[model samples]
Target: MPKQVVPEGARRRRRPTRQGTVLSEELIVRTALRLLREHGGAGLTARRLGLALGADASTLYRYFTGMDDLTRAIGDELMGRALDGWTATGEWRADLRALGLAVHSSYLAHPQAAVLTASRVTGRPREIAVDETILGILRGTGLPDGTAVLIYHAFIDQSLAFAALDAGALALTDEARTGDEGVWATTYARLPAASHPHIAATARLLTDRMPHSAYPAVLEMLLEHTAAQVAGLNRSQH
Candidate 1:
């Protein structure tokens, strides 16, 4: 990537607000994250961000090239937070499971931001660190390098894909979320048994369970299959 142009001379100096809070790229990205959380996706505009930071909208351009650059920075921050306290155990399967859950939970915590950033490959420092850490974990499992790379691709993609999809649901407006949450209970549960035997038969279970995201269960399945594959590869090598 080409070097992002920083504003010249005077603009490079810290700009203090009337309240004495200094503005910098870090502060801007942090404020943007808050704006995204309090307001939804549409709330993350230059005007709103400026208001939130107590700086002029034009000041933002001095820091970020545009909204896209700021967003990628925010995404990199999210990746950093996911692995904040994570240290890998020598046990590969357990370590991967922990990392996967950490990533999922971090995105869920910032659903609005995740909606914008989860599918993106930011290539920023923290994002690159996450990619490296995951690949290392998979390779340590003793899978062949080729197999490790393939599984690493699948694991990371699946985790982020589901995170984005689930976060999209969570990011809905209150009314929409409520209506969606009630679908299994209100719609599926009410279908006549004569017309929808299978759905009707399991409607009670579905109503009780369907409102929850299934990412955790799905992650476990992926990890278990990968473990099985690794074990089989080890046996064959011996």
Candidate 2:
């Protein structure tokens, strides 16, 4: 006789581990995030996650189909964190600025996880909720549906793109990151004005600013343009 396969739900309902730890999807995701933070992306293996959770490696499958599934959950988890304790300020521009900053900061807080999952579309509840909130914010500005959607896409993508880029740099080893920064200070800052007048003139400012993420500045520019569009619409209506 062939052995029977257990249903996923049944497996999930199995008794707790000998350590008395009850494994849930939330527990697994949080543990995976912690592992990613401590060990980087390459360290987020099933064996490692299982060890961290104090359960057998195969037991994780009771909740998730595989690591890919877990990756989506982890990404959604970051979005959830961004929404936690967040409330809209009623001013569309201010609300959007806060939302973008919240998402960017959440990703940077988990650089390893961001590097792995930033570019993904999780389609999970938290991700969907964030999308809805952003679109609602844009629409509340009295913008047309199509215009609201176009700006929505650009805004969210810009936030994630910058987060991933900065997170990648943040994930680098301390020595490697410092060396990269040193090139700007030693080489760009020392460029001769005669040969490279433009760079030489701005060298000090470049060295000061280049090491930081430009997301905040760019976000403001985008919002400025958006505010202009909203003002234009209001002017025409009156």
Candidate 3:
């Protein structure tokens, strides 16, 4: 499908916030984000981003101090877009499941932007809020604070790790075409049954699995394990 046109506001020029001139983090991030999506990870350098925004590379320096900062901003912005309209109903498991799936879906949606954002936590507002929510859910389970923090960290990391890896492979990596198939055929299916019985048993299931179901299916198993951990903790505390 043809990508959408950049709104006039999304472009940047070296100028202060003046009566007629509009300079914003959103504008800069969005333009760079568009470029990142279209050109893959290597294309999001400060020079190319500037050119895409109709300005010199130096103009971007005014908005973002450096490429790393700019990349983080772009990652945070993409996270925000992925999180729009998400509300919780106080069902902790469902809320967390929803949150994880939301983030995964969002990151996967813009696999380009996600390739950069998923690995690093910029401590951006949306990310902080997401963290707070996850920890809050764990705490609500009545576990001690330390335990809650550890579990929450593990859960968040795992979800993002899987999400980011798949996104990177699908959108950012060069072997997008056959890397997935190679893993299924040459790696998992080839393992001897005596050495990897479970994997070998599930080889056909793994082989028949479609690309789209990969993230969500793995996410379900993660949630199940996490939920059991929470349950175990609850029992121990009682």
Judging by lDDT against the true structure, name the best candidate.
2
Window of ten residues with lowest summed lDDT in model 2: 1-10
Q: What C-alpha lDDT do the candidate models reach, one value each?
A: 0.86, 0.90, 0.74
- Which regions in candidate 1 have their CA more than 4 angstroms from the true location? 1-4, 7-12
Clashing pairs for predicted structure model 2, backbone only? none
Model 3: colliding residue pairs: none
Model 1 lDDT tens row, 173-201? 88999899898888999999999999999
The per-residue C-alpha lDDT of model 3 at residue 3 equals 32
Q: How does model 3 fare in lDDT?
A: 0.74
* RMSD values, in order shown: 2.4, 3.0, 7.0
Better of 1 and 2 by TM-score: 2
Candidate 3 Cα deviation (angstroms), residue 140: 1.9
Off by over 4 Å in 3: 1-21, 172-179, 182-203, 210-214, 229-238
Pairing residues by index, what is the TM-score of model 2? 0.94
Better of 1 and 3 by TM-score: 1
Clashes of 2: 0
The model with the greatest TM-score is: 2
Candidates arranged by TM-score, highest first: 2, 1, 3
Candidate ranking (lDDT, best to worst) = 2, 1, 3
lDDT of 3 by residue, 35-64 (tens): 878998888887787666666667666666
| Candidate 2 residue lDDT tens string, 1-238 | 3234346467564577656788888988999999999999999999999888778888777777788888999999998899884789899999999999999999999999999999999999999999999999999999989989999999999999998999999999999999998888999999999999999999999999999899999999999989998999999999
